[model samples]
Target: MKRSVLFAVLFSLSLHAFAIDTKLMVRAKAKDAKFVGSSIGGAHIIVRNTINGQILAEGITTGSTGNTGLIMKTPKDRFAQLADDKTAGFLAVVDISEPTFVRVEVISPISRKNAQVHASTELWLIPGKDILGDGVVLEIPGFVIDILTPNTHQYIPLESIKSTGLDVKANIVMMCGCPIEKGGIWDSEVMEVKAVVKKDGQVFGELTLANPSRNLFEGNVKIDGAGSYQVLVYAYNPTTGNTGVDIINCVVTE
Candidate 1:
């Protein structure tokens, strides 16, 4: 009987010494916008052990963009919950014997590689403790700028280009896919959009894009006998220090 009791006690102690599964929730929030979710291509989440660089958990956030009123409109007090059960997040359960320092990385709007922004943070996680409810919110700053004109690797006749200047256009929106319009939530008036033009690796010129409609910025670039032209369209919100860029290459046949 004593031997059996001793063996049982040892087994219990061994189990206690083993690692505990801790729950961690990670979310990607677009700066000045909302959560990065399935509608705009969910954010890729990676949680790693900072000391040994071991990836503890890896997954993509899934769900909605979250409540806009709570995230954007409402005045937030201390410890206000901006996310709900449906809010997009990646829940990771990590097994750790003791407190471990971890690095959390998020690549937002994963579908749009051209406009994807990376954000990361580090914190110590205690065993058996779960960080849920709004979790670790990492803010991604930038706009999603997609160049609409001068399609990627497009070839245009030299005569056609000379007749009319190149029309540069882009679709600009917040990283969360929030529409940027005049006097809207994301005001376009406060942002600047431009297209940097280049020819054969030489600086050609730059054009200030004007917003003619919601989420659309357009400009005209005077092609100076284009030869292997490249256009990079970018959007910058000076007030928020947010910016994003998308590039396209086209050839003007001589």
Candidate 2:
């Protein structure tokens, strides 16, 4: 125990002589797109000195674990896990001339299908500070939904068929102002969730959404009589007591 503490202290004193090594763990999630965090290529990642705005490092976040980003330093000691679940975790050394704060930026490229993603986070560090337990979580917030499915704004050919009910199914993504991991977002304190449905500008109906699975809300909406309609889906998360919304457009034939 004394040896570990002594080594840590000595390393702190040697900051002026050598770069301070540290590990940076991050999680990326896509709300309206897929793989933006775990598999959708990588983001234009960067770490900058918040004091001078000078960039410290550049890289991307990829792989199945959402870590695999700009890794500049290797851990001096082994790390078991950071939070409730273990993250593959991105690692950065962050060469420090003195103890200070730094910023992390991850901007995901435009999704081939849906939207874009960007993230900014800041953390304070001391030279030779412990970099293991729970570390800093650089959360990259992606879009709002994975895909509206069948896409939106569709004209069913004014005379295509004769169906009474319009069935709308979508896998909605809800972000509880939390971090992302393993195809999902964590940090919910609520037990009840609902998806408020709307047509045009008026409340149509509401559907109780099941527990989210893999960052998606599995729900459906049935509209009996339709004209030119705008379908809106609002996901209510009681956790932070916030609601996320998305829209779908469709035209029903006469």
Candidate 3:
């Protein structure tokens, strides 16, 4: 868990810093609950347009010299670290099409199993001159859960609301740094998965979600009237007392 080893990555960007070309010395958190300690072999790192979802550039972490010497020209002594360790340091180069915001997607192994059982996280990046400084810092979250209804990012349809109720679901998983179905990992059997309803940021009702799948839980809410409503999903594990929460906003109209 002590991924605090010092390293360097240098990008020769004088003015055209339109892409992520740098060395990464991973600086881990104080208590990273999801640290796997070893490189996530064969992980795919992608930099893309957040709005249009267009892929700008992509690279794969090979736990060694996949793109080290191929992309690195004479890197400075500060860029001495190699991409030999996935959980530690590496060289990453990303091309940005335009000066706009972007999203970095990391889909990596659920342990070293070819990353076939994979997990992903989307970290946002602002338009910058270069991908220097702290390098690309990405957090493989300890858990993953998001609103899975309406098949979008926290957006619910206005017409989908009926007088009876509205159903909202979420897919929750534990990032134990290993495969789930393989049994050597922490499971996603939530102790309590509840959807707390709030109107204009005021607390109102909370419903305990019912599990429809091993990794999915859902709840129903009947709205009297809605301008903007917030559905806060909270998932807790009694075994570890670890919790994960997410928020989704919906606007209902006639």
Off by over 4 Å in 1: 1-17
Give Cα-based local distance difference scores for all models: 0.91, 0.51, 0.52
Best by lDDT: 1
lDDT of 2 at 254: 58
- Tens digit of per-residue lDDT, candidate 1, span 152-241: 999988888786799998999888888999899899889888899999998899989888899999988777584899999888888889
Candidate that would win on TM-score = 1
lDDT of 3: 0.52
Indicate the worst ten consecutive residues by lDDT in candidate 3.
Answer: 23-32
The lDDT, on a scale of 0 to 1, for candidate 1 is 0.91
Residue lDDT tens for model 3, 26-137: 2221012332233434345666667898876666544321232422344447655323333332234444434555666565433433113333335544344454433554
Clashing pairs in 2: 31-145, 32-145, 35-40, 73-93
Q: For each candidate, what TM-score against the reference?
A: 0.89, 0.54, 0.44
How far is 67's C-alpha from truth in model 1 (Å)? 1.4
Clashes of each: 0, 4, 2
